[model samples]
Target: MIDKLAWIRIENGAILTARSHNRDTYYIPGGKREPGESDHEALLREIKEELSVDLILETVHLVGQFEAQAHGKPAGTLVRMRCYAADYHGQLAPAAEIEEMVWLTYADRAKVSAVAQLIFDSIHQAGLLK
Candidate 1:
């Protein structure tokens, strides 16, 4: 199983997502935790690396944890995603391996990764996303 962390940033009723270079599907920003790193530390570092923004640690909160079949992996591989909601400083922009940054809504579900689709469902249901 692959374990990952994601930053859930919602603005104007849309969620922040990113598409890596040469990739077709968009995914929530954040990445795997490094050895000895806590969730918040990893998330902060990953987001800054991917999005070029500093996450406001004081505003961080757990959104949810989701598990699903890992996308594009061999059968039997699973991914456990721990998601968090947090405020950030600085403008959002694509960086590192990211080629594009997008704000996605429910209508754009088909353009995201499976795990992101599930995150959208939960956020939409809670009226946190439109």
Candidate 2:
């Protein structure tokens, strides 16, 4: 199982996301699972590593599961993204290999990952975004 954790942070009603330096599309602030880490732990660690912010675990709200073909990989290279909404501390800026950070609305779906687009669709259907 290719597991991953995604942080769905809603700021001023817009979702805070990042675009990898190597990819054209944006993605949720997240990463692949680490050894023996739970979903929440992985999310916290990834958020900290990528954004240099400590995510409040208690504030992290589970959104839903998103499964899609992993971008830039083979057709069968699927990913299961477990998403969440959360509050965090410190200013969010690009770290590691991230190229840019953007607050995106549902209208920018085409600029995000395939699985991220699915999450955007669901968020729109639920009346959470435009």
Candidate 3:
């Protein structure tokens, strides 16, 4: 199993997603946490490194945790994604290894990672995605 953290940013019925360099599928922003780091710390650091944005510490909240077959990994490999929603400051832009950033709706689910597909379903069911 691969454990990861992700940021959920929905605006106007679309969610923010990123595709890293050399990767074909997009993933929700945020990444794995470093040792001894709290969820907020890791999330803050990852988002800054990946998107060059600062998450408002007080606005961060857990959205949900989801699991699915790991995309591009062994057939049975599972990925557990802990997702959070937060307000941020600064312009969103591709940074670090991210090659592209896009806003995706429910109809575009197939373009993202397996874990992200589950996230889309949850968001859509909650009436957040178009």
Candidate 4:
């Protein structure tokens, strides 16, 4: 299983997502934790690296944990995604391996990873997403 972290940035009823270089589907902006890194530390680092923005540490909160068969991976491979909600400073921009950044609504569900689709469903059910 691949463990990953993600930042759930909601604005104007949409969630921020990223599409990596040469990737077709988008993902919530975050990445796997480095060796010996805590979730917050990893999340902050990944977000800054991928989105070119500094996450407000004090504003970070766990949104949920989700698991699904890893997208585009071989059968039996799984991905466990730990998602968080946070406020950030600086303008959002695509960086590093990220090719594009987008704000997606419920209608854009099919454009994201499977676990991300679950995250969208949960947020929509909570009436937090459009």
Candidate 5:
């Protein structure tokens, strides 16, 4: 299993997301933690590297944990996604190796990752997409 963390930055009713370099599906920003790193530390570093913005750790609110088949990978390799919502600073810019940064709404679930699609659906059903 691959452990992951992610965050949805809400702005003007839109959610910040990233598209992979070779794929169209969008995903929330965050990545795996290095050895010895805490969840907050990993999330903070990954977000900054991927989005070019420093995240305020205190703004983080635990959302929900999710598990799904890892996209484009082995069937049994699952991704356990720990999610959060948080505030951030600086302009919303895609950085480092990020291919594209996009804003998505509930209606855009079809263009998201396998796990994210489920999360999006849940958010919509619970009236949290807006």
Candidate 6:
């Protein structure tokens, strides 16, 4: 299993998604935790690196956890994603390995990873995504 962290930023019923350089599918922002790092530490570090934004520490909140077969991996490989929602400071821009950033709604589900599809399903069910 690949354990990962993801940030959920919703605006106008769409969720923020990122496509890394040379990658075809979009994914929720954030990444794996570094050694000995807490969730907040890793999430803050990742969002800063990937989205060029500072996630307000006090505003971070768990959204949900999700799991699915890993995309572009051998069958049976799974990704376990822990999701969070937070307010941030700074304009959202693609950075680090991220090649592009886009706001995606439920109608754009096919453009993301399996775990991200699950995220779409969840938020859509909650009536947060159009």
Best by TM-score: 6
After superposition, candidate 5 runs with Cα above 4 Å error: none
Where model 3 places Cα greater than 4 Å from the true spot, the runs are none
The candidate with the higher TM-score, 5 or 6, is: 6
Residues 18-94, candidate 2: write the lDDT tens digits.
98787788998999877888888988988888888999988888899999998888879888999988888998889
For model 4, the stretches where C-alpha displacement exceeds 4 angstroms are none
TM-score against native, each model: 0.97, 0.93, 0.98, 0.98, 0.93, 0.99
lDDT for each residue of candidate 6 in 1-130, tens digit (9 for 90 to 100)? 9999999999999999999999999999999999999999999999999999999999999999999999999999999999999999999899989999999999999999999999999999999999
lDDT of 4 by residue, 1-130 (tens): 9999999999999999999999999999999999999999999999999999999999999999999888899988999999999999998899999999999999999999899999999999999899
Give the Cα error of residue 19 in candidate 1, in Å: 0.3
Query: For residues 63-111, what per-residue lDDT tens digits would candidate 1 score against the true structure?
Result: 9998887888988898889999999899888899999999999999989
Query: Compared to the true structure, candidate 2 yields what TM-score?
Result: 0.93
Q: Tens digit of lDDT per residue, candidate 3, span 1-130?
A: 8889999999999999999999899999989989999999999999999999999999999999999999889899999999999999999999999999999999999999888999999999999999
Better model by lDDT, 1 or 4? 4
Report RMSD (Å) for each prediction in the order shown.
0.7, 1.2, 0.6, 0.6, 1.3, 0.5
- Give the total clashing residue pairs for model 2: 0
Worst 10 residues of 6 by lDDT: 90-99
What is the lDDT for 6 in model 2? 93
lDDT of 6 at 28: 95
User: How many backbone clashes does every candidate have?
Assistant: 0, 0, 0, 0, 0, 0
Q: What clash pairs does model 1 have?
A: none
- The TM-score measured for candidate 3 stands at 0.98
